[model samples]
Target: MNKSVLDASALLAYLNEEPGAEAVEKSLAAGSAIGTVNWAEVLSKAMEAGIAPETLAAELEKRGILGNTLDVLPLTIEDSMEIARLRPLTRP
Candidate 1:
């Protein structure tokens, strides 16, 4: 099965009982799992929206999604420097 990377938007949609929840649910049903680096961001949004952490954890478990599988891809020092170098030209 192919792995998909899910950003905050997609995760939030599933957690919030939104329109795209079905699609996300389908993906999981088909064994397509998601990976993310920004877990704290996602968790914070869920908490702010009144989703109990236990509920979220249970849902993820039911969907066969494990928290430990999330990939934390941090920007390297060189990458950060490169972005900083290009920031001025790219800034709106």
Candidate 2:
């Protein structure tokens, strides 16, 4: 299966067990990645939910979602431009 790139919302939905989580889980299980910016967004949302960063990291690690399932990709200049170009069409 092709590796999928997960946005902040999709990861958040999976983390919170909300709708569409199953799809996110399937993607993760099949190998997926999340860009650094989106990972930051996930951290921000977790903070807003009163979860400490360490706790969140630990929880994800325990669930095998960190290094094993989801790979976090560092943002590059070209990636930034691409994200900007796709923002309008992708933003919820």
Candidate 3:
């Protein structure tokens, strides 16, 4: 199975029963999971929308999702430096 990297938008669609929810579900059924950064973003959005953190956590656990199992790629020091360097450049 090809692994898919789901960004925050995709996860939000799944959680909110949006149009692409089915696709997201299908991906998960095929063994595709989310990265930690995306997971955190999804949880943050859910919390902002009034979904209790514990409830979300329990639901994810019930769905056989494990945070530690995600292929969370870490940001290297150079990557961090680049982001910092580019922040001012992209500022409006």
Using TM-score, give the best candidate's number.
2
Better of 1 and 3 by lDDT: 3
Pick by TM-score: 1 or 2, better one? 2
TM-score of each: 0.52, 0.87, 0.65
TM-score of 2: 0.87
TM-score, cand. 1: 0.52
RMSD of 2: 2.5
lDDT leader = 2
C-alpha lDDT (0 to 100) for residue 62 of candidate 2 = 95
lDDT of 2 by residue, 16-45 (tens): 999999999999999899988899999999
Residue-by-residue lDDT tens digits, candidate 1, 8-88:
777678767788978765654554434334555777777897887677767776655754443334556886689689999
How would you encode candidate 3's per-residue C-alpha lDDT over 11-66 as one tens digit per residue? 68987899898987776666665656677887888789899868887787776754
Model 2 stretches with alpha carbons more than 4 Å out: 86-92
Q: Candidate 1 overall Cα lDDT vs. reference?
A: 0.63
Compute the lDDT of residue 34 as modeled in candidate 3.
61
lDDT of each: 0.63, 0.91, 0.71
Alpha-carbon RMSD of each model: 4.7, 2.5, 4.4
